[model samples]
Target: MNEQETGERDPGSGERVHWSEDGAERSALWRSESGARPPGKLAVADDRMTADAAYKLACEGTALLWRGDYHGARQLLAALARRVDRKPPKEGATPEESFHLYRQARFRRARVLGMLLVPLQISHEGTHSAYSVPLRRAPEVAQACEEAYGPPGEELTLVSLRELQGVLGAHEWRRKGVPVEALGGDRVHPRHGVFSPVRGEYVGLVARAPLPPGEPGSLVAFDIGTGTGVLAAVLARRGVGRVVATDLGERAPACARENVRGLGVQDVVEVVSADLFPGTADLFPRTEAGADAARADLIVCNPPWLPAKATSVLEQAVYDPGSRMLRGFLDGLAGRLTPHGEGWLILSDLAEHLGLRSREELLGWIDGAGLCVAGRLDARPEHPRATDSSAPLHAARAAETTSLWRLAATG
Candidate 1:
């Protein structure tokens, strides 16, 4: 069938089809680090393959090529997951250790199970084929495919069903968006891989925090690392005359721009593609924009607060090595603010509880940067994970509290 009918032209999906050397099987394929190597090793499975057998094979590091009815594959996948989740925790593990172990186990399970491969292909008729996927209940995920893989063109590639499901979830989140009452109940639609601002306390801090005093008609702020531009939009709607938002992620600038436009604050908010700040890495909002050259009356930064190694691209938003972003923001704030200005640092104490970073170290960095905490506001996390007793890090989560540090440059 033709690629167009199967919806290959979807934005970011790809333009045309690309094929393999032999012109038979998919050429481009990727699997999780733990999955079996080389697509050639993947053997096709059908309705006859029992879920127990599939589960055993998958657990033993064998990648499955599902050629059964689509619905059956999905059921198989679910059964596999149920089996994995039902496994008992290790004996003699402490509550804290158990949490860490659970996270590790779940991560490993996901990586191995992600080996179940699905294919997208075209037939000679150039018409939308039976999803090129066998199954009575398999869906036409052309749109999802396009969004995730772009147009693989004619190349036949195998993607994990787990990965496809993740893409579909992100697509749905982008389509429907998460509501932010601080933004007057408006929603922020996160682009693929961009961090979604579902946590409301941080936004509430931005909404309720007092704006630095300036001339009656003066209101300007800088939002560093504005992911979905939710904080920047809140400032603009709060009557800030101008707000400069900067982000470095590949899709973050576009995501922030779209959100600002949706919030009807594009005129007041500017989204810049940058690392840390616009120009110099040593200063906050260190730009040379002619009219907006002056230092800001208020600056806000919500850095990746945790100090750890990130295993995936999406995890980078939450994990930071050496607290780089946090230190950079603190280091440059003293030189970036007006006399009465304040640098609002939205952070959490999770890293401290996990022993990844210490309060003293963060405070030392702030002091070394010539900044001082004017005051701090705190809010406990409202996410269900905090209350999940089974969570490997439940103790840390329950004790976690997000803080908005009202910082002032020390002269």
Candidate 2:
């Protein structure tokens, strides 16, 4: 029999009913109080409600008070997902349109499913309540929280159910690894806060482009802002004798090192921690070693594509805010290059399509830096987001193209 049928009424209704004093029973009471409920509707007693039933009810604007085991609710939510995915696709839609619709639908579905993850708060009495969510995978969550948020306190600790799921997903991605054919049947596992080279179109361009006429393996390339070290690995595989991968993030230094080691390129690739160019002090030679510091025969950089502020450190790989990294790299290009050395800047024109920046402005920057575009190679992004029209910037994405700008120092 369900908990409600034995003479229970809505607690808020203040009707007298049997109240269990046991800690287990009290825990159930706590969940009912803190569980998600649809706005402006009275929650009635129901014990047999499954997570799927609850999700469906919530989607249809109904609320479920979970009286089952906490872990059981998670399983129920998973079942609900199967039902949603089983539904047929919408009719009369093009592939591009369908792709966009799928992303939107998936996003909405996740948001709804996420609501079912109610937090369980542990109290000092060896009992738990639902006033707030206790950290999941508490040790790791606590560490990440400490890094992102300050040390924990009695501030009613909270985190987005969605973001927690994202962390778990990222962990899985790191474990499984990302495949790179350019690395000769190898895969690179990028850690959290590091860039993942999922789309290979740009990397392919670099791998296939002819090196300046010289000894086939004579080139020494510097991969500036090397996040996951994918580009550096690609260059190494392409027969570059030496590669130096640089990044400023503490996490990135270790991440790049791991990736470099994983792809078996550690012998020729050195991952260094630095902002912009390394081994160059103050842009002028202060010492003889600094003066003759190894100049790159082929310098490559894949700067953050968009011109916007990063919301978090993790977003730094995707957002360049003020085009600072791109501009800085361009301004420093002349000094860092060997005679006749070419700088390959892999970039996207999504900003222009989004009305955020103009192509002329970009060209102006290149010219102002005393560098001239020697030649350019172009490719289309193959990320699923490109074809997702329902995305906020779909119109801009449809018109975007990625390019490898071959630049030569004019000064």
Clashes of 2: 0
C-alpha lDDT of all candidate models, in order: 0.74, 0.66
Clashing pairs in 2: none
- Candidate 2 at 198: error in angstroms? 1.3
Q: Candidate 2: TM-score?
A: 0.65
Please give each candidate's TM-score: 0.82, 0.65
**lDDT per residue, candidate 2, 1-411, as tens digits?**
222212234566422223222322322221111122222221222336655556656475333333345445556666667666665667776444554565567655654554443333323334422233443323234433332233444323222244444555556667788888677658888766666888788788888777765664777788999988999988888888888889996878888898888888899888888888877544323323636555788889999987875544566887788999999999988778878788999998877776667899999999999899999999998888789975545656777799999999998
- Stretches off by above 4 angstroms in model 2 are 1-158, 280-294
Clashes of 1: 20
Residue 409 accuracy (lDDT) in model 1: 89
lDDT of 2 at 197: 84
Q: What would the C-alpha RMSD of candidate 1 be, to one decimal place?
A: 6.4
lDDT by residue (306-335, candidate 1, tens digit) is 876555556678878778898888888887
